[model samples]
Target: MKRFQILFFTAFLFLCANLLFAQINAPSPIPDRVVLNLTENPATSVAITWRTDVSVSEGFCELQPAAEGPLKKEDSKTFKAKTTTIKYEYGDEPVIDANQHSFIFTDLIPGKKYIYRVGASDFWSEWFEYQTPSVENDKFSFIYFGDPQNDLKSQWSRVIRSAYRHAPDCGFMLYCGDLINRAGRDVEWHEWFHAGSFIYGMVPQVMTPGNHDYNDLMLDPHWNAQFTQPTNGPKGLEGTCFVIDYKNLRIISIDSAVDSELENENGYPMQAQKVWLDSVLQANTKKWVIVTTHLPFYSPKENRDNKHLRKHFQPILEKYKVDLVLSGHDHSYGRGRVSDNPQAGHKVMYVVSVSGPKMYEAGDKDWMEHSGADKQLYQLISIDGNELSYQSYTASGELFDEFILNK
Candidate 1:
């Protein structure tokens, strides 16, 4: 009996020791997915979003000078920024849910490279570096794409890889909308990050919300959880709408979902959005203005005439002498020069493009200077002085269209 008791105690102690060892050997939650988004306020700021396996109550990132040459003591100095933890819940009974964290880094030096890394508690992620463009870098360039909506792993990766290879020098990226078919799908978001794995961690991306970007009526949980942009928009328009100023360019992003007529009478957010847009455009001190959204004002796919939007916003765009309008959702490519009032005066070119596997027949219109029906493509815009050069390239790096916008 004594020996048996001693054996039982030894077994219990061994089991406890094994449990403690297992806990110690367990892996820490590393930052699996990371994304950098550009804010409209200025080129001196950027928004970073990342995900972890467990809930993070608090998070922060350390930024260091990404300067070349040998590292010195002074070069090792670090700057830290705190992140805001955003909570998100889904389903009726609240049984299924998750939390996402984001942070905005501001007051950064433009045209300077900075290295950064995120961490939560004792878990630290790997270091990544990015450069902020100078407000005066008129020679800057960017990549514009639309709708990476379906087959994210296989098809979308090809598009993203092709764009990265062709436009490696692009300072930033713009997604017109429909990044994922369903906004609330965690798996889809994961695939999106994976598809753009090559450039996502390095390049800053500016995204507009699409119809599919929002979840079932009344909720845009995924969008709110993933992105953080300028909130200087109209009342109640918050994340769904915002603006960012890069160099001499002003990029305005609006949520057409709220602006669309699908909402109830009292939920018409477009009126307020337009009122705010008028003020923004009227108050603009920038040299050039570009507006971006998910729905196209001139689509070759679905309803060609976005009647409500055209009726309410087109006049405002023309009235403000807006230079360009970039949009997605048509699943095709269309660019046309618009002269206010059809009288041929001040002109603004509206462009609709798609970057996913989907395709739609290009409409034939006199105003349409160029249109494509079959290839998956991305656009690269280079702005130098008063000249804006636009080039649309296929996934295989073939130049499908080219145009120049003179100021």
Candidate 2:
């Protein structure tokens, strides 16, 4: 009876211990992969998007100027700034259902270093720091890459890392759509983030949507969830389409998907965006006006010519005398001047290039002054007053093409 009792007690204790271990060993719902968007407005404001496994009913961020004391012992400049947080929520689902959150920190000082960290009820994120660009810099540079579609892990990572290694001091990074081949898959999005991890947190990123960025004949959940841009520009064209102003540069991004089939029959071209663009261009006394889209008006890619887009937006670009039009979806490089008469003043330069593993053959065309095929490239653009300098570099950081635009 004594042995039986002892054995029974031992079995009971063992079962309880196993149950406790199972409960304790369960995965913790912690916030992860916090990415700071350095592209939008980095000086006056910065945006951060992070993912969490558990739903956070309420959350906020704390920020302070990054200290350069230890790094520069000879030069001691103590920096301090008040921290602010902008609260937001997506869907009313429970914590387990909610996965992504984005917040914008505004009213920041340009050219100042700021340290920040996010906090939530279930879990708290680590502290990270970044510096805002100096608005006073007359000559500023940025990186432009397009279409990181297909083979994101092995091939695309090289291109992204190469660009970062070459231009570490770039003010911002512009990705002209198709960040991933399939947007619905969480793993692919993770790979996209992994490929661009080095620069994604450091530099500001402005992204446009490519056809592959979409899923199931609609906007992809991943793209929509990760980015936050100006939605107040046009009523119907919100996320996929918007406009942002940085220093003397006014960037206008449009959703080619909407205008691709010429389906918006209610004077679609002449209605909202046209009026808004006219007002923006006319009102914008900025030194440069840049338009970015996923689809190029003239691309060498098979079955990728956007005739309707050219007919609708080309006149507007000419009327506004836009400085440049950057695009991708061609998987090759093509640059041309949009003026029918060369002496009639440079209207706009339409450029298409790719920065992914995919390559396409370039077709011989009269409009194409510079063309490249069988290579992966990204563009580095420098704007100084009236002069705009552009250099196209291959994945290995070799200058493949170069040009200048004298405004």
Candidate 3:
């Protein structure tokens, strides 16, 4: 009896020791902050990114075609994820550290649904499905949000969820900028990811960095680490200023580092973007063209005019007859084309909106056709051939304003 008891105790201790070893080796290897970002060609490629604890040195993504019935793991192909360790220090906070992983799936069939998940080794995320944009010139839509900077989990989450409810089939989401209140604070980025939850994993993102996304107009290191963007911009600016030709429209993202107080050897980053924009617009073969950036070319509030932005970019946009100029930073909602005849909307439509809980009264409203304040709003823009339809909705899913432009 004594020998049998000794054996039982030894076995139990061995089992516990193995469990502890496993725990230490794989400490919270679960993937989090998973997001999908757009590549240059949405029809044939997509980029995905995620995060995990430092224990997960390596990561992977499993891809499978979507079909009816249960997913068969045997039918899926595994692709390794590139992982990088990110360490951040807040103003007076402890250092935040984690592993970020990213992968770009290329040569995909257009207009097809694909299932994927990301993780390392035995830990993985649940299967998420995303549809590719069709190259057949079919109608494509995307959701646009202004600034999701404050009260992310408590307030901004509802705005993103409401956008999902409205446009479940959106090809991708466009964030004008100011995604958080701080530049390099990991907690704010965590809240931004938590607010979107699984929605970000499915629909890809196209982002422009706002002032708050930078410290002293210097970009946060997290941007380059967490995102893999198009390298089509001119020298000195690659991911921040890029052009993606998605279906019938040519989408261009420009950086606002030159809007006010930023300087480099290249003279304020905007010069290169202007040259790139001119070339891209001159050679644009798509039926429509839209530009999205952080600061508005036309400010919607008093004493907030972006004179430099207007002086440098306005002529180029007018010369090419760009369809829309979407931007944030005013914290109020304003949409109108600056034309002599408001009825004859021959020029580009400029829109400025906000999605966070922050409120700012519009001191300038005479130039706004559809204006509102203290309302968190989202816009769904659809393009089918020559007609583009835009609908704006409040956080509670009420339609706030809308407009349609024909090319």
Candidate 4:
């Protein structure tokens, strides 16, 4: 055990040293931490967000047909990005003052490929190509990752890379919260963005906030500044909780950390979200509904129950017969249905998974149809007209578990 600790610390130091060297030797003026996301309507709208040093204050995105020649820059439409000044501080590091830029290109031709890039003046990122979903409902697949909370650069990078390899054309990827071990830590966020690399620029990200994503009982400003999500959530929870429609599926993200952890301030109770979520689920017109929260209603870890969260949200989920609920927080993996008996009526399939190096012993409960301890896993979910298919895979690309649901 002593030798293992020594080796682990040595490797950690080595990784940090390399990161510092890269930052000191090579700094790009264009932009870093570029990521894509879906707008309220992904078929006709797409959003991109990125960060730049304070110098590059003004930014814009250029879009053109993917087939157009590279020299046709004059024919592309340039949209000015909304820039916000973001200041982040963590630990002993000096405060970071950076500019975050966001742009949502709307009224786009559906089912067509387009190349886009973001920057200002003479500095710009490489062209990134993306395709909009069909205007009408179409079959699509997406990847879901749970709690990439530890060893992001050193260990968690493989999980996301393998997932991309498994589903290169997935419409988008969803992070079920706990993206990092520390909240508002610039170094940790850098590790996360570095681990994902260009994958974030290719596939849009749908994310929720986990308990670990907060510092001092409040969300890190970096989250709201970096992720451009739908703003149709309840008060005090703008981007953290909202709903988006993609093809035939409706995804509702909930901020379970603040309320369940008793961090609610200024009357932002779970009840408020209960009312909003009930309405959201009630008004959902999509054939399929998938709700994602960081804390699981049915806990798979002993002594770590979120009864308050379940009390407020599970009824709505079961009432609406939500197709699936994806979540992570216990640092373990479990997939299960609501009932142990086969005769149970309508139920929602709940999944808790992990994607980082952290692991915890599983608490074998009767609800778990499949349970795994000390494993890093990702899930690929695909939806057709009347059916939804789910497959779980390990870091090595092994099929860990799978199931199918019919509407």
- Order by lDDT, highest first: 4, 3, 1, 2
In order, the Cα lDDT scores of the candidates are 0.74, 0.71, 0.85, 0.86
Tens digit of per-residue lDDT, candidate 2, span 225-257: 666666746776666677777777888887775
Candidate 4 structure quality by residue, lDDT tens digits, 1-407: 99999999999999999777645412246787889988888988998999888888798999988865544867699999999987777776756788899999998998989888899998999888899988677678999999998999999999999999999999999998999888888778888998998999889999999988987778877788999998898888988989998988999998888754644433555767888999988998889999998988777887777766665677777778788889999888888878322343567889999999999988978878988988889999999889899999999999999999997
Off by over 4 Å in 1: 1-28, 67-98, 259-267
**Alpha-carbon TM-score of each model against the true structure:** 0.85, 0.81, 0.89, 0.91
Span of ten consecutive residues with least summed lDDT in model 2: 80-89
State residue 174's C-alpha deviation in candidate 1, in Å: 0.8
Model 2 has a clash total of 4
Candidate 3 structure quality by residue, lDDT tens digits, 1-407: 99999999999999999767533322258988888889998888999988788988999989989969898889898888788888777776546677889999998999899999888778999999998988799888999999999999899999999999888989889999899999898778878888999998999999988888888656877887777888888866677889999988899999885434333424747677878899999999999999999888777777787766766777788888899999999899998887433444356789999999998887765668888899999999999888999999999999999999987
Which residue pairs in candidate 3 collide?
none
Q: Provide the lowest-lDDT 10-residue window in model 3.
A: 257-266
1 or 4: which has the higher lDDT?
A: 4
Task: Report clashes for each candidate as comma-separated counts.
Answer: 4, 4, 0, 0
Q: Rank the candidates by TM-score, best first.
A: 4, 3, 1, 2
On a 0 to 100 scale, what is the lDDT of residue 67 in model 3?
A: 66
Which candidate tops lDDT? Answer: 4
